[model samples]
Each structure stands twice: as structure tokens, then as C-alpha cells.
Target chain A: MNTAAALSIGVFLFTYALIISERVHRTVAALFGAAVIVALKVVPWERLPEYLDLGTLLLLISMMIIVNIAKESGLFEYLAIKTAKLAKGSPMRVLILFSVVTAVVSSVLDNVTTVLLLTPMLLYITRLMGVNPVPYLLAEIFASNIGGTATLIGDPPNIMIASAAKLSFLEFLSNMGPIAAVDLVLTVGIIYLAYRGSITVSEGERRGIEAAIENLDENEVIRDRELFRKSVAVILGVIAFFFIHDRLELPPAVVAMAGASVLLIWSGVEPTEVLEKVEWTAIFFFAGLFIIVGALVETGVIDGVAQWLLGYVSDTGQALVIVTWFSAVASAIVDNIPLTAAMIPLIKAMGSSMNVYPLWWALSLGACLGGNGTAIGASANVVVIGIADREGIRITFLDFLKVGAVIMVLTVAAGMGILWLRYVGV
Target chain B: MSIFRSLIDRKFRSIAGDRYDEIVKRYREFLLLPEEFVLPEVESILIPLDRFSGDFHGVLDVLEAYRGAKVRLVYLLDAQTFRLIEETLGEEEAQKLLQVERERGKRLVEALKESLEGFGLEVQAEERFGDKGDDVIEMASEYDLLVISRSFGSEVTKTSPISPVVLKVVQHVLVPVIVY
Candidate 1:
């Protein structure tokens, strides 16, 4: 490209890089970049609305509303307490409980919420048993990300991807659900190796903890009875609607918006409060990023990059390896949502006839697995970190990346192999 | 302070002090960068602070969004105010204050997060208690960003709006302090 176009994209990258390095406020960064692109007329200011991605926004808003109400009802604490009781005192038991609890919570709610609620409890529970909460915390974080993969609602990236790609809940279930289930089992296995020493249990402490957990049940945490009852039904109904949205020919966003509205009307949750929970900064960031990416697309920069990569990895055999590996690494550095979106059209263009469906599955695996690559790789990682800080256990970037690298590689390999066999007759 | 307590405090202060320098550095960097930014693949964050001056969640909400992509937040508390609030307001009243704080904090964070994430950033929130604001500065750099609330300073001088301790934090630590 010419110097001016190159200069604009470079400016965008530098700004994004600064953000990646956390040298700025994300919303401000996004807005700045967007304003520049608009003002400079790189992609023309008129094209902004086309990039809104409203489907993604509506789903996120609805889910945020749903989760906010659920938290109000003390749904997360209830799950955590119940999981601890089920696990008793054995470290292995703790891992099992944490994995299950985190996964389930993340699936219906979001990974961030799951970690926010469970990580502290994990820290407190582990410390109470005289063990380091780090390893368990990591496992819970990984498990939450994995578990959230089973359904579209589990993670925001996935939700955005599903909505943007027009994939149904069943599509997510069919492709991601199996991978997530298998990934969890493998994760639980590896964690068994990671924390073998801490999993041991004494009979007395185990029962004592279990009995204590039973006493302070969710009812104790949730004081509002009617609100609680209303939320339970809404959460359940939303999930059911998501699952059946495809069969009914309904877009997931429609279902989400409807669910959010019902929640507002039935539960007496103020619309203002619900709107407040929408995470506007995140929304603006997405809009700005879209414009930035659109700026690249408009200038044919992404197309150029896509063409170069497309030529190198055209063989089905080579393409699979490259896509999986690149996805894992690329997702680790860049937020996977944008990265995945940029790639979809490119992958289809290059291997239009090679059954890109499996490749899509590979991207899913890579994006999800890659998220474990760093503390910033996925929402699940951030959520648990937030909770861990509350308990005084500090997990640095290097500290988390060290373990995250291993999990990403192992799960991506395992997920790729599973899909290969099913689709390609490995 | 007893000898054992003194040793723990000294070690904690060292950690927190170091953390404070890093926190200031991050905030400075955050303020300086161009507005169109994308954070690193953030997963877990570690913030070590001594004590906060109350308005804990409000302060946390601002610093927390800058926490790389996909956040796991860790807050180091002073345990002093943790107890004070528990005692003065008693467990029930303190919890009520905390509950209100959590709700408001959630709203604000959600707003901030949406704005930030809209630019491709993810955030996770966390907290802990130790002694005071002085105690967490040492460990501030260990996190993506360190935030010390004014609650830490409030313990020593209840009459003052912003205590000398908080001023020291702003002056000394390299991190950011959302003082109210």
C-alpha cells in the first residue's frame, strides 16, 4: 500500500499495541482510534453504523441483565457453597468441585462472573486447608473458560462470534459442547497432576467443612424471596430459549432481548439499573475496534494479509496444522473475537471447497484453548485473578502465562485430534 | 506491635511499597498512551495494598478496567478497616454498606468495562485486607495496575478528608490512587 494508508494502519496498530501493553484506558484508546479513522476519512465517516454488530450487543445486554439479577439472588454463592460441600476436604475433591462449579456457573452466566464469585471462595477454602490457592485458582480459571465454551452464553467472545456468524445455540452445542466436555475431563486430569500434593484430605476437616457449607445455604445469602424466585425462572427460561432458538428460527439476539425485557418487567428490576449494567465501555471499545478493523478492511490491508497466509497454507493437511497453531498463538496475543472474525472470510476464500467447517471448529478450539495462554487471553482468566487479589494471592502475568502455555498446547492438540478423527477420519 | 507482628508488618510494607511504585508507573503510562489502545491478553492480576480509605469499590472500578484483556483481579487489604467497619457498624451494618458498595461498584464497573471492552479490553475485579495503604505499595508493581483506596488513610485521621498517608501514596508510589 501507499505511505498514507500505511501510516493510518500503523497509527491504529501502535494505539492497539499500547492498549495491549496496558499503557492506556481501553475505551479512550478505542474512541481515539475511531475518531482518527473517521476524521481522516480513512474508511469514510458514513460507514460507521454498518459495523454496529447489534446482534452481539443485544445478546450481551440481555445476558448482563440476566446475570446481574441472578447475582442479586445469590445464585453464584449458592453454587460455590454447594460445590465445596460436595468436594469435602480432599484437594482432588476441591479441584472437582471447583471445576464443576466454575464450569456450570460460567455456562449459564459468564466466565467473569463465575470467577468473581468462586475464586475468593476457592482462595479462602484452600487457605483454610493450609494449601496455596494459586494452583486451584488456575484450575478453576481454566475450567471456567472451558465450561463456558459448552454454550453460547458462557463467554462474551463466543457470544459475539456466534451472533456475528449467525450460528445457533445448537451449532455451539454441536461443535463446542463436545470439545468443552472433553477438555474439562482432560483439564481435571492434568490438574490432578498439577496439584497432587494438595488434594489429600483428613476425615475431620472434610466433614466439618461440608456440614458448615450446608448450614449457610443459598437461602441465607439471598434474602429477597420473590425476587429470587422470579430470577430462577428467567435464567432457566433464557437458557431453554437459547437452546431452541434455532429450531424456532429465532436469532439468539432476539431471544436475549426478549429475555432481558421479561426480566425487567417481571422482576421489577429498573430499566435504568439494567442499562447501567450493559458495560458501555466494552461496547464502545468493540465499536471502535470494528471501525479500526473496518479501516483495515476498507484499505485492503487485512485482505492482503489474508491472501499471503491463504497461499502458504492451502493444503488440507498443512492448512489444518497452520490454522490450529496460528489460532492458538494469535488468540493468545490478540483478543480472539476480532482475530476470529478477520479470519472467517479469509479461510473460506482460500479453501472454499475443502470443508472449512472443521477449520471453524479448529478456530474454536484454538481461540478457547489459546485464552488460557495468558491472564489477558480470556475473560475467565481475568475473573479469577480479580477474585484472587481479594484474598491476597498475587498471580503475575509471567506467573499465569507459564502455566497457561501448557494448558493451551495440550487442549488445542486434544481438541484438534478429536475433530480430525470425526471429520477427516484420522 | 509484638516482634512477630512487627516482622510481618515490615515484610508486608516492603512488598506494598514496591507495589506502589509500579502502580504509579502504570497509571502514568495509562494516561500517556493514545486513546485508541488494545490491552494485552490479560487473565490474572495481582494488586498488593496496605489499607484503603473506604469507597473501596469505586476506586477499584476505574483502575480495574485498565487490567489487560480477560481480568482476574487480586486486591490486598489492610484488615484494619475490615475490622473497624465490622466493629463500628457491626457485622450486619457493615455488610449492608459493603453490599451497597458491591452493587454500585458493579454498575460502575459494568459501564466502564463496556466502554473499555468496546475497544477490545476485558476486566476482572478482586480485593484483600492487610493493614493500611502503606502496606500494599511494595507489591503494587506485581499487578497490571495497583489501586489503593482512601479507606486506608481514613483509619488514622477520621476528621481529615484525605489523610497524609494517602498523600504519601500519591507522592511516593509509582501507581495510581483513586482517592476520594
Candidate 2:
């Protein structure tokens, strides 16, 4: 390898090591790596913007602001309490309702935010019902990953893929949505069966929980009715805009940004407060990651990897399975964001030889669903586990792996099958 | 000579500004304080209850020893719990949950007060919202004796260690403590 190629590869691997070992914060590690590459003249400083996908960054920021504002209205808490009340103290029903809501919400919002808002309330509800929250928390973790797979904007990897491929929101939904729904059902079912004994409540305990839940006033939880109304309206309008944004020749980021701006103005919330809620670390992490990955592309390293990957496969179908399983396992071990970041360019390089459209779905499915493989696999998994730990309900890595790995394998297999049938034909 | 001294003082003040004043205030407040050695007779007793774990009944006999003493029952809604909630949701939601927990704490204090009143001791109840150990320590000086449960800050089993809050209160409070 040339000096530039070797240096970029070394910096990338070293940065990845730091992130995986968690010796340094991932953002700091990524930025450090990016800085080393630029400082060494491996990737020029001025060309940094060429690699940073503003669409993905903008979409992430806009959605975070919107969710932050909406949360202030107490909408998520209200929904959670309402869902628990709807369950009427049945443990199984609560599990189902919570899992479904988690999935549906995750498909629209980011998984981390979805889990952050829901997990605490889930813990509270389960504690009240006198049921073990482990099963419910596990279900939500899996469901969030599965649900995030259904839409382009849902998962970070999918957002990166959509922005790169110029895929529309409807395109992602139509392709990944069905399989995500199927996986959600299957995962929740397995969880319920596996933990049925622990989640089950006695008759008297059920009656007591029912009485307690009755006293929980969901309406009282809504902090601002006017803001809530405005938020719901803007969010719905944003989603609707996402549906036809392609027809209007608008990028997903534009739609999301417009919605965030309107909500910021309409809700009369302090912009600084709402902006502070944005995940700036993730944004900067993405920026640095793009530059690092861009170094690979600039050094022709991605082309070499693509050629090596193509040497094994004859057609897109075989490549689909390879990409799906490979991405899944790789993402299970590493953060899916960086994995997707590196894979996007590789897929583009491979697009030169074959119809690589199906490969996007494969990458999306594999990367998004693969996050369920371990407790540390996805941001959502880490977040929920952190919250659970703080609440004195420990979910160890192995404990999560035993369940998350199985669900991940099942979901990825289903996604591969759906992609095969849809694109590769029976 | 006085004018020269004033000029020097003005220069020092300009250089140090608020930090100098803060240090002076702290020095006056802490370093110059008189030492207190006398222990007051047990005329008023304070009992800080943990909503989930403290054993109020275990201290009844201790209270009965000071039969006619005034007992003040305080239930503090744990700010730590709401802080955890805030980490997930925002501050506004955590505040709302704190309000709910405060109401619950009030009811608990009232029920404890009613039961203590039945024992013929003059009891006053107050609900607070803050760190349990810190709040108790702050209020400990006002009362002659403090009766706290072994599991003051956390839910515990027989094998569990004494709560950190209990340890802190024991080490820091000036009053005599009865850990039930």
C-alpha cells in the first residue's frame, strides 16, 4: 500500500480501537483520527465538507429538536401512561402495548430518543404492576431497533443510506416496513414466552395494579395543551411532507429542518433551550467520521475493499446475502453508524459492476437490525441499559446478548428473505 | 499614610474583585466561628422517613423514652430519583413527577403523624423534597435527637449494607441518633 493509504488505514483502525475499547469518548476519538489524517495531509482540510453529509446531520439535528420540544409538552409521558392504563394491569397486554408503541414511535423518531422517553415510564409502570421490567425492557430494545429499520429517517444508518442513494421515505418504508413489523411481532412473542413466568402477576396483584393505574391521570401529565397541539400538528405535517418530499424534489433534511423551524417559532420555546437538547456530540462524531471514511475513499482503499468483496460474489443476490449477514455481524460488534459510514462508499464502488439497488436494503436491514445483537451494539440498547441500571434493574451484556442475538439473527434472516424475493425473484 | 493604605487596598480589591470578598466572607463565617460543646436535653426529636425503606415502627420505643418530647416527622421526596427521571425525560417532566412524589410524601408524613399522635406525643409533620441525608443533616441541629432507619436512603434487605445516607447523617449530624 502507498504511504497515504497505509496512514489513513492505521489512523482509522486506531480510532476504531479507541471507540470500541471506550478508552476515549467516541466523538473525541473520531475527531482525533480525523485531525491526524488532515494534519498528515492524507485528506486535505478544505475537502472535509465534501465528505460530511449535511443532509444526514441536518435530519438528525432537526428531529432531535422536534422531539425535545414535543417532550416538553409531556406528550410521551401522557402516551405511556395512557398505554399502561389501556393494558388494565395485564402484564402480557402491557408488554404488547409498550412494545408496539415503542416500535411505531421509533420508526418516526430516533431509537435513542424513543427509548429514552419510554424506558423510565416502562420501569415505573412495571414496578407499579409488580412485574419484572427486564422482559418489557428487552422487548422495547428489540422493538426500537426493528421499528427504526422500517423508515429511512428512523435509524442513523438508514438515514446515511437514504441520503447517499437519494432514496425516498416511501421507498424505505415500502421495502423495509413490512419486514420490520413482522420482526417486531416475532421478537415480542419470543420475549413474552421466555419471560412469561416472571411477568405474570397474581389475581390480587392485578386488581391492585388496576386500582393504582386508575388513579394515574394521563391528562394531568400534559404540561401544555397548546404546545402539545402545536407539536402534534407540526410533527404530523412533517411526516406527511416526508411522504411526498421526493415528488417535490426536496431532500428529507429540508422537510425536517422546515418542520423544526416552524415548531421553534410556533411553540414560543426558547431556541437556545431546544437547541441545547440537540445531540451535538453525535453530529460532530458524524462529521469526523465522514472525514475519516472519506480518507479511505480518497486513498483508493475503499475501491480495493470493494474489488476484494466482489471477487467472492457472482450476482447481486449472492452479494445481498453476503452484505446482509456481514453487515449484521459487523454492526453487532461495532457502532452501526461508523459501519454504515464505511459501507456506503464501498457499496457505491461496487455499484459500477452490478445492479446495487438491492444492496442498499441489505445494508440497511443488516446494519439496523444487527444492533439488537448485544447490549452495546446500538445507541438505543446502551441508553435503555443505562437507564435500567440506574433504576437498579441491571441488564448485563451477556443477559442481553442471550436474547438480542437471537432476535437479531431472526430479523436479519427475514430481511434477507424479503429482499431476495422482492429484488432477486423466487 | 492612611491614604496610601487605602490606595493599596483599592488595588487589591480591583485585582481580586468578587473572589476576594467571597473568601473573606467564608473565612469570617467558618474560621471565626465559636465551638459549641453543650448537648441539649432531648426535648424535641426529628425523624426522617424514607418512603420505601425506613422502619418507623422500630423507633417507637425510642420515642416513648422521651414520652412527652415533641416529634417532628419529615418525609423527603428523593431528588435523586427525580434527577434520574430528568436524565431520560426533560427537567419539566421531572419537576412534574417531583410534584406527584411530593403529594405522596405528604400523605405518608400525615399518616405517620396520625399514628404517632395516637401514642400521645406532640407530633408535627412536614414534607420536603431534596437529598435525604443533606436535608436531615441540615435540620438535625434544630432537634436534640434524630431517629433514622438503617435503610434511610435505599431499599435494603437484611444482608444489605446500611444505607450511605444513614452513614452520612450519623457522621455529620451534631445531634444524638438512634438508627432503628
Candidate 3:
């Protein structure tokens, strides 16, 4: 290899190491790496825009602001607790509800936040009801990973895929979304069968759970008469605009940012506060990541990787199978967002070599599914951890990793099978 | 048993990026007004709606003497004078301001109720809505003490120095007003 190539790889490796070690905040590390590459002139400023994709960043920000408002409504906790309350303290029933809700919410918003919001409530519920929460939390994380696969905005991997593939919102719904839905049902089924024995709750357990719910303070902001109506209108409009904006030649970025702006002004949020809540770190991570990935692409590294991987699999069908398994494995340790972003160009370059665009679907399925492999596999995991810690529940990384492995296996296998039968087998 | 104990004893930041410890420290001082007081028989206690914090159980522990007081929980909502929001703005902007006011009102009310149990005031919360001063003055004749909450709406903007309606309620009410 040449001096420049080795230097690029070295910088990337150092950044990844710092990220994994948690020695520095992720945003700072990402910004620092991006800045170094720019300062070193590894890639000139002119090539920067090619590396950056504003769609994913804008989508993330738009969703975060919307979700922040949604959270204030107390709907997440209220629903979870209300559902669990109906279970009458059955540990197994609670586990099922936790997983299902975690997945549903994770598919729409980030899974990390869903788990974070639910975990403490889970812990508190479990503690009060005299039951263990470990099983339920593990299941919740798994469902979150599986559920995140259903849409373009559901998880980072899907976003990376959407941006890289230039696929529209409808494309995902027509293809991998249904596949992910099936995989999720299977995951829930498998967990229920395995944990059925532990679910049996005595009457005493039922009463304990009832008492806990009775203790909840339900003075919800959902009662905000005017804001509630406006917030709902603004959110529904954002959703509608996301799907139809393509026809108007309005990019998803403009629609989302516009929706958020309207919601802020119309619903009475100060501009500064909304802007402050925007996670510039995640945005910077994308900006820097794009530049780094773009640099690699410019250097012909991506072409090399894509061509080799494509060459290794004779038919496009085989490549699909490989990418699915690849995503599941890689996602267990590293976050799927950056990983998926890193792979997009490579997939695009080599996608035509395949029998079809099957590899694109494979990559999407794998990256999203891989998030279930470990607690840190996606952004949602961190959110869950943070929320749980606030409520005094400690879900260790290793604890999540253990269940992550079981569900990751089931999902990867299911995805590969789906790819072969749908795109390859025929 | 050890795990349960640890969970109950746990301490962490409350709001994202807020110095919850400092807030707690400030609230502890506010709750201990008058410095010293003799024990009173358990009967009734007016939990001044706004002067409370997320430490209700601890507060209840201190006032254990009032074991069975039927607690009247009052939430003071600042009816938010609309001069700043209403001043010199287009009709669209004015409507938007009203939207924010209602959301701010609900968020504050919910947050207050959620954190109330920490004080262990066996409580019933009543939100006396409308502009804070006039509404609170009218209701002061009925309650033992008025709890003062930190202003729920935006800080009195430089554009409108209306001094907030909560202040007016504190001034006019014959009953003692608790402000945090």
C-alpha cells in the first residue's frame, strides 16, 4: 500500500478505537477525525459535499425534536404502564408487552430512547411487583432491533441504505419492511415459547403490580388542550409530507425541517430551545463520516471492497445472503449507522454486477437486524441504558449482549432465507 | 434485599443536562423556611402547590407528626399575560403564542403533580387556572396556604415587563404564599 492509503486507514482505526473505548465523547471523536482529514488535505474541500448526505442528518434532527415533544405527552410511560397493569403482574405477560411496545416504538422513533424511557419503569414495576426484569429488558432490546428494520427512518442502517441507494420511502415499504415485520413476529414467538414457564404469576404477584400502578402520578401533559391538538396536527402533517414530498421535487430534508419549523412556531416552542435540542453531535458524526467514507471512495478503496465482495459471490442472489449475515455479525459490536453509511458506496458500485439489486435489500436487512446483536449495536441501546440508569436499573453491556446473540441468530437466518427465496431462489 | 435497598437509595441526574443536585440543594433550603417549628397534630396540611420539589417523601418524613393530614395539593398556574406574545405581532404569530401557552401550562402542571408524592403530603392537587394573580386571590379565601411555583411560562421577556401574574397572587392573598 502507499503512504497515503496507510495513513487514511490508520486515522480511521484510531478513531474507531477511541470510540469503542468510550475514552472520548463520540461527537468529539468524530469531529476530531473529520477535522484531521480535512486539515491534512487528504481530500480537498470540493470533494466534501459528495461525502455529505443532508437527508439522513435532517431526518434524524426532525425526528428527535418531534419525539422530544411526544415524550412530554407522557404517552410512552402511560401506555407501557397501562399495558403492564392489565397483565396483572404476570412476568411473562409483562415481558411480551415490553417487547412488543419496544419494537413498535423503536420502528418509528429510535430504539434507544424507547428502551431508556421504558427500562426504569420496567425496573420500578418489576421491583414493586416482586419479579425479575432481566428477561423483559433483554426481550425489549431484541424487539427494538427487529422492529427498527421496517422503515427508512426507523434506524440508522436503513437511513444509510436509503441515502446510498437513492431508494424512496415507498421502496422500503414495498420490500424489506414486510420482511422485517415477519422476522419480528418470529422473534416474539420464539421468546414466548422459551420463556413461557417463567411467565406464570401467582395472585400475590398480580396484586403487587396493581398497587404499583395505583401509585403512578397520571397528571399527563397529554391534557394540553390546544398544544395537544396542534402537536398532533403537526406530527401527522410531517408524516404525510415525508411520503408525498418526492413528487413535488421537494427533498425530504426541506419537508422535515419545514415541518419542524412550523410545529415550533405554531405550537409555541422557542426557536432557540428547539435548535439547542438538535443533536449536532450525531449530525457532525454523519458529516465527518461522509467525508471519511468519501475519501475512502475517492481512493478506490470502496471499489476494491465492493468488487471483491461481489466477485466472491457468483450470483447477485448469493451476495444478498452474504450481506444479510454480514450485517447481523458486524452490528453486534459496532453501531449500525456508521457501519451502514460506510458500506453504501461499496454496495452501489458493485450492485449492478449482481443478478439484481438484491444486495441492497440484503444490506438493509442485515444492518437493521444486526442492532439486536448487542446493547450497543444501535443508538436506541444507549438511550435505554441512560433512562434505566436514571431509574436506578443497571443493565450491563454484557447482559444485553447475551440476549442479543440469540435473537441476532434467528433474525440473520430469517433474512438470508427471505433473500434467497424472494430474489435468488427463483 | 440488598438490591432493593440499593435501588431505593439510588441517586442520579433527573432532567437531561440539568444540575439536579443543585436543584435539590436549593429546594431543601426552601422547604425548611422558619428554621424551627414545634410538632403539630396530624389533621390537615396545605401543600403550597408551587414551593414543592421532587422530595415529597422526605418532606413527609420530617413532618411525620402530621401523620394523617388530609393534604390539599394546590398547583398555581401563571395565566401568562399575553402582552409580549400579543404585542405587535401578526395574527398567525399571536395564535402560535397561544398554542405555546397551553402546552407550557400542561407541561408545568404535569411535572408538578408527578413530583408531588416525594413530599409525602397525603394530597389532592387542584389546578386553579387563569391569570395567576386574580385567580389565586379569589381562591386564597378558601385554602390555608398557597404554594408558589417557579414561573412555568417563559421569563418575562424584555419586550414585556409584566412582572408575571404569580407575583400578583402572592401579594393579594390573605393566606401565606410559598414560593420556590
- Provide fnat values for all models in the order shown: 0.00, 0.00, 0.00
**Given candidate 2, what's the lDDT at residue A56?**
95
- Per-residue lDDT of model 1, residues B28-107, tens digit only: 33122212234443343433333233543454455545535454333444466557989887899777766665565455
**What are the chain A TM-scores of the candidates, in order?**
0.91, 0.97, 0.89
Tens-place lDDT per residue, model 2, B51-157, is: 66554676666576676789988887777788798999999999888777777777778777877777778998877778888899999999999988888788766
lDDT of 3 by residue, A232-254 (tens): 77777876876876677776667
- A1-426 per-residue lDDT for model 2 (tens digits): 999999989998999898777677788999999999999999887888888899999999999899989978878777877888899888988999999999999999888778866776677678777678899999998999999999988999999999999999999999999999889889988897789799888889888777777767778767799999999999999999999999999999999999999999999999998897677878989999999999999999999999998898779999999899999999898889889998999999999988999999999999999989987677777766766664677777678889988899988998899889999999
The Cα local distance difference test for each model comes to 0.66, 0.84, 0.64
Better by lDDT, candidate 3 or 1: 1
Segments of candidate 2 deviating more than 4 angstroms: B1-180
lDDT of 1: 0.66
* Deviation in Å, model 1, residue A137 alpha carbon: 0.8
**Model 2: what TM-score?**
0.72
Q: Better model by DockQ, 2 or 3?
A: 3
DockQ of 1: 0.02
Ten residues in sequence with the least summed lDDT for candidate 3 chain A: A214-223
Write one digit per residue (lDDT tens) for candidate 3, span B49-155. 43222224444344444444555655544444445545667667867866764565456445544554444546565655465456557766676555444342224
Model 1, A1-426: lDDT tens per residue? 775479567856876775665556566777788788888888776777766667777787778877776666655555666676677666678888788778877777766656666765676567556677788888998898788777777776677667656778888888888888888888888777876776766788776656544544445655467877788888788888888998999989899888878988998877787677666766777777777766776777766776787666665666777778888898887667656655665565555446566676676677767888887677566555654553466777778878788888888888888777777775
lDDT of 1 at B148: 46
Please state the error at residue A383 of candidate 1 in Å.
3.9
